[model samples]
Target: DTSAFIMELPAYHLPYAMTVLKYALDRAFSFVKRAGTIIFAMNVLIWFTSNYNWTLAHVDASQSILADVGKVVAVIFAPLGFGEWRATV
Candidate 1:
C-alpha cells in the first residue's frame, strides 16, 4: 500500500528537513520584514478607504467604532494571544 511506501522514509530525515526549513523560513522572514512594510501600508490605506466609503453611506463615523472593528478582526485572525491566553492572565 501507499502507506507502507511512506513508512519506509527515514525517521532521521526529520532533523535535516527541519534544519533546512528553518533556514528557508529565516530568509523568508527577513525578506518579509524588508519588503512587507509596503504591503502593510497598502492594507491600512485600503482599510481607511473602505471606512470612508462607509461614512459616505451614512454609517456611524466614530473612532470607537473603527477601533472595535480593528479589535474584532485582530481577535478573529490572531486569536492565540488575544483570546484564551490573555483571558487566563
Candidate 2:
C-alpha cells in the first residue's frame, strides 16, 4: 500500500514513520472536514452567475451573470481573434 511505502515500516524508525503518517493523516482529514464548505461556496458562486442577469434580474441563461462576464472578457480578447462571446463563455 502507498501508506506502507510512505511509512517505511521496515526501513525507518517507527517514530519517524508515525510522524510522517500523522502529518499525512492530518492533511487528509482537514481536507475532508473542509470539503463541505468548499463545495457550498462554489455552488453559491455558480448559482449567482447562472441565475442572475447583468440587470440583476432572474432572466434566461443567455443573459445570466456568467454570460455578461464572458462578453466583457471577450471584448478584451476580440482583437486577438477570439470574437465569439459564446465561445468565450
Candidate 3:
C-alpha cells in the first residue's frame, strides 16, 4: 500500500521549485545592483576629495579619511569584482 501510494503521487512538481528559485535569483540581482551603486558613489566621492587641494595640514587629514574609506569599501565590495574599481580611482 505504501509503494502504491508513493507511485500515485504526481510526477511533475518542478514548477513550484523553479518559481521559488526564480524569486531568489531576482532578489540576488537586485541586491547586487544596489551594492554596485553604493560602491560607485563612494568611489566618486573619494576621487573628488582626493583631487581637491587644501592646506598641508588639512590635506593630510583628508587623505587619511579617504584612505580609510577606500579600505572599508574595498573589503565590503570585494566579492563584486570591484578590486580594479577601487584601485583605478
Q: Which candidate achieves the best lDDT against the true structure?
A: 2
Full-model lDDT, candidate 1 = 0.59
Per-residue lDDT of model 1, residues 1-89, tens digit only: 66756655555634588889999999999999978998999888646644554344424333333544555566665645654222321
CA RMSD of each candidate after superposition: 11.3, 10.3, 9.2
Q: Is candidate 1 or candidate 2 better by lDDT?
A: 2
Candidate 2, residue 77: CA error in Å?
Answer: 2.7
Give the Cα-based TM-score of candidate 3 against the true structure. Answer: 0.41
Checking candidate 1 for backbone clashes, the offending pairs are none
Better of 2 and 3 by lDDT: 2
Task: For residues 1-89, write the lDDT of model 2, one tens digit per residue.
Answer: 56655643456545688889999999999998799789999999978887898678898767899887888999988988888676676
**What is the Å distance of residue 43 in model 1 from its true position?**
0.8
Full-model lDDT for every candidate:
0.59, 0.82, 0.65
Q: Which stretches of candidate 2 lie over 4 Å from their true place?
A: 1-19, 32-39, 79-81, 86-89
